[model samples]
Target: MRYLKVIAQDRSGKGVADTLHVEFYEGDQLQRKATEADRQRLKSFSKTYLKCAWFNSGEGEDRHVRIFSHNPSADGTPETVRLHFHEGPVIAYKAAAHDLDNDGVFELILSSDVDNDGRADRTDRNRVRSLVREFLRVGW
Candidate 1:
């Protein structure tokens, strides 16, 4: 499993000071297909949010989704969406996606700070669940 560090930012190009960690596991890394329960969970979560028709994969056919919090205080410029992706301590947003397993399936596991509160809580899990569902709906 590979890890990416995503730092949410606010308008004015300031970091939200919250680091959200996500793990990317290729199908080969997991060595298994998504379980039935996983599929159900994904379905349930995706139903809670409207289909994201405006999501831009940005020059790739890998099928992906980007989710972020709307900062009302920042005039809704999607400051949170302008995330800084890092590998270890190094910024590496350019090569963010890879077919590590060569099986064409990659799983992203959000580790913490799903709610951007700098702490793990129930809300974080739910947010992660929703994200997983949405990702599977569009990314897989």
Candidate 2:
């Protein structure tokens, strides 16, 4: 597994305000590690810090993950290991551009999930309409 650290501090002081430490691991195997320092230097009074990683899998497909863990084994190792799994909703999201009322330039067509199941039905026009309405309202 790989380890990373992100730190956030007050802009006018020299003490750290918050820190995020992460670890990256492959299906049971460990891979590359990353941290915010890998990106830029943090001033003693910085406001925020981020440690991110973009992992590439060798299985012919592409995937990404955000890691969060907090645990330390006295032997001098991290204490916790956790990975979150996210799957796009069934309805997914598609795009279209047209003035439903044909007024002028496109109305910025969009879609939303009405079922509230966290997934949208890609093929259902009603579902698509629901998504569009939601998008128009809050751009969700």
Least well predicted 10-residue stretch by lDDT in candidate 1: 52-61
- Tens digits of per-residue lDDT, candidate 1, 113-134, equal 4343566555654555554444
TM-score of each: 0.28, 0.20
Per-residue lDDT of candidate 2, residues 1-140 (tens digit): 33221222233333322332233455455454334653232222122111111122222112222223332434432233222221221222233434434343334433333223455354333433332332233210
Model 1 ranges with Cα > 4 A deviation: 1-11, 14-111
Best by TM-score: 1
Give the local distance difference test score of model 2.
0.30
User: lDDT of each model, Cα atoms only?
Assistant: 0.33, 0.30
